[model samples]
Target: MDNVITVRDLRVLDGRKTLVGPVTFELPGGSTTGLCGPSGAGKSTVLRALVDLLPHGLTRDGDVEVQGQAIRYGKGDSALRSTVVLVPQTPVVFGGSILDNALFGLRHLVRASRAEMRDRVEQALREAGLWNEVSGRLDSPAQALSNGQRQRLCLARALALEPAALLLDEPTSALDERSRDTVEESVAALRGNRTVLLVSHDPAQVQRLCDRTVSLEHPETLALSAAAA
Candidate 1:
């Protein structure tokens, strides 16, 4: 299988303080891989580095290749983000109808007519496991959905981009048990069809949703990730 993303000796630094690894790993195409560790291990930070979305005052060193193309640091944030969409732990709902939120950011990345855009959004909604709940009310307010629905909508928004890989940051940690299950169902649905890199502290969730695991430890813990399962 081919790797959608390849990282070598990736690191995140604050001033001279080494925050996160000199870790290396590959995300095989169409595979869901888990990134797990104790708190502050930089699991989320690694995701940011992969797409050049590292926060202000922090810098990264190492090579990141997306489908064999090198991702130059601090360049083309828009393009890189569109290619590998990141859905944060907290769901963000924009001011608009469900349909509008679904099409958010999508309008800039892909070119298509209104009808075509709707078609793509519809497909994404299905892929996110949100179609059955929101299909009839796409015109309704986006904020009206439950928390789980909101997260799935965010997932649909990213899926609409048809990203080469999806970077999910502890997607279910903030939800209630029932909501978590629904989100888990959605992630499970993507197991073999979407290339996903998921970060979660929960070992059981990783076991349930991922094909393999990558372990990240503190700065002193040797900046290399564990072997893929």
Candidate 2:
């Protein structure tokens, strides 16, 4: 299978210090891959690095390719982010109706007629497992949604753009068990259809959702290995 995203020797750095990586992995098209490690292992940092969203004063090193095209460090642009969208751990809702929230990302990246945009929104909502519940209330205030629904809304927002891959950062960490299960269902449904890179601290979650796993060691562990070598 062709890879949707490829990383080799990827690392995050702060000034002169290494904060993450020397991590490497690949996400094959239509497959779900898991990135799991202890807290402070920098799994989320790697996701941010992939799309050039790393926080200020931090930088990345190593190689990343999307759909076989090399992504030069410090050069990932808006176009690159559109192609490989990141859905952060916290769900962000805008001050708008549900329909508007769903169309947020699409509005910035795609120009389409009203009908065309609606169709895409519907498709994305369905893919994110949210359409059936909100289909009759497209105009409702987005704030009315529960936490789980909001996360799915964010997922739909990304899916509307038809990105080549999704970088999900601990997609269910803040939810109650029921809400987490609901979001997990949405993510599970995406397998075999969308390329997903899922970051989770839950080993069981990874076992249940991912086709493959990439384990990152703690910074101390890496340092110990280096010292031993």
Candidate 3:
């Protein structure tokens, strides 16, 4: 498989505290990789860095490449946003109808016509396991859906863009067990076509969905290991 994303000697520091290591890893195209660790172990930080969402004043070193192109962090570059989409733990839904929310991401694309957008939205909603539940309520407020449905809608929104990769940060953390399972199944279905990187603390989830796992420890320890090598 070809590499879709690469992290070489990546490091992020928040003031004097080193958040994550100068870690090196690769995410292959059309595959799913899980990042597992305890809270405060830098899992979310790594995701943020990948998406160029590192907190204010934090400095990042090393390199991140997506689809063989280096990410120009902090440049407001549209390429990264277009090619990679990050779905954080909390799903943000705009104040709009379900169909409107589904079509939100594609509204600006020149080639996407009204009919195409509607068809794509319906198709994506079906693929996300939300169509049966929401098809009758296309004009209903997005906020009216249940938590699980809302999360799936967020996934649908991301899919509408047809991004090259999707970064999910604890995507199932806020869900009940049943909802979590549903989300897991949806994620599993996404494999082998879209590159997926999941940041999760659930070991079982890691074992079930990921082909390989990456664990990050303290930054100082990683630095020491590099020096020793």
Steric clashes per prediction: 0, 0, 0
Clashing pairs in 3: none
Query: Which residue window of length 10 is worst by lDDT in model 3?
Result: 220-229
Residue clash pairs of candidate 1: none
TM-score of 2: 0.92
lDDT (Cα, tens digit) per residue for candidate 3, span 1-229: 8898988888899787677787778888887788766788788888888878888899888998888888878898766776788888988899989998898878854257799888888888877888999899899999998788889999998888788889999999999999998888888888787788888888778777776667775222111122211
lDDT of 3 at 77: 75
lDDT of 2: 0.88
Top lDDT model: 2
Consecutive 10-residue window with the lowest summed lDDT within model 1: 219-228
Ranking by TM-score: 1, 2, 3
Best by TM-score: 1
lDDT of 2 by residue, 91-197 (tens): 99999899999999878888788898889999999999999999999999999999999999999999998999999999999999999999999999998999998
Q: Candidate 2, 165: how far from true, in Å?
A: 0.5
> Of 2 and 3, which scores higher on TM-score?
2
